[model samples]
Target: MPAADQNATPPGFGITLDTAAAEPRVVVTGELDLLTSPQLQEALAGLIADENSRRVVADLTGVTFFDSSALNVVLHAQRQAGERDVELAVVPSPAVSRVIELTGVAEHLSVADDPRP
Candidate 1:
């Protein structure tokens, strides 16, 4: 069999993780959709599994796009965290804040400003 292209990106277009935790903080910056949702999913899974982490903050400042699939991923993460008795915050960027508000999911999330440098 032929070897697959190594440099080529995976099925997802743009999905990356940046862990910024000063004691307790998880900043995720990237686009999440049908393709890249798994990355976020994995992060959420890891957080909820950690008993010491009481809060999980998702920094969406770098994300310029949003869709139903992305929303679903977040919602699922919310539920997962809730089940584990953890708090989930959605730190929406100025760009994505309006869309999240319009979608009516903002109320449920702990909407905060992006603390990016």
Candidate 2:
């Protein structure tokens, strides 16, 4: 997919889980903004509900935008993961990282900057 496709919407964002990783991982691509946050939460729920998967690594390599609504979902997921004693790691896109850092969400998200493309 081209970079142009990532900023555009329901068509862009996608989540895929890789259970084969040793730790269950979720691949997050495209925009996770106001319009797409719910989808992210839904996808996260599918993994968070499973008791067997403790470590959740979110790969935000292709994400280009971030919003407070998306922050809510990530915070919610982090809280749930905390309650379950599941380790949560977020590989945030630089854009997303900057937003989180500026908004004080950096503390809540166990985030890394500029991951693989």
Candidate 3:
């Protein structure tokens, strides 16, 4: 039995930040669960904290798995964005859409079918 590599990144999981756009975009891919939700939280929080940021787009179209943890992050980010006077929109993939729809959180957050506004 060999010890697992704790420092290794999970396969197919990635988070990319694009601030060059008119609105900052956080692009997420792969599974989003308890282990990876923190990363998302951090990313969104940073974007929301920017005083000049008017909107933030979270592109989850590449996500293959969505979980409650990820949903929590999204909801929290939405609230934060609102408080900061910043809009938060989510572009969901099929996997994420199912969870968002089932949880009935879709009404609470802004959802976009297309990545662009």
Candidate number achieving the greatest lDDT relative to the actual structure? 3
Model 1: lDDT of residue 30: 55
* Candidate 1 C-alpha lDDT tens digits along 34-109: 5666667777778767878777777776676666777787888888888888887777765568677788887666
**Each prediction's TM-score versus the true structure:** 0.73, 0.81, 0.93
Off by over 4 Å in 1: 1-20, 23-26
Q: What lDDT does candidate 3 reach at residue 107?
A: 90
Models sorted by lDDT, best on top: 3, 2, 1
- The C-alpha RMSD of each candidate to the native structure, in angstroms, is 4.1, 5.9, 1.5
Clashing pairs in 2: none
* Lowest summed lDDT window (length 10), candidate 1: 11-20
lDDT of 1 at 96: 65
lDDT of 2 by residue, 1-117 (tens): 545553355767787878777777778888888778887787677677788978778777778888889889989998988888886788888877888888886777777543332
Candidate 3 lDDT over 3-35, as tens digits, reads 877645688999999999999999999999988
lDDT of each: 0.67, 0.77, 0.94
> Distance from true position, residue 114, model 1, in Å?
3.7
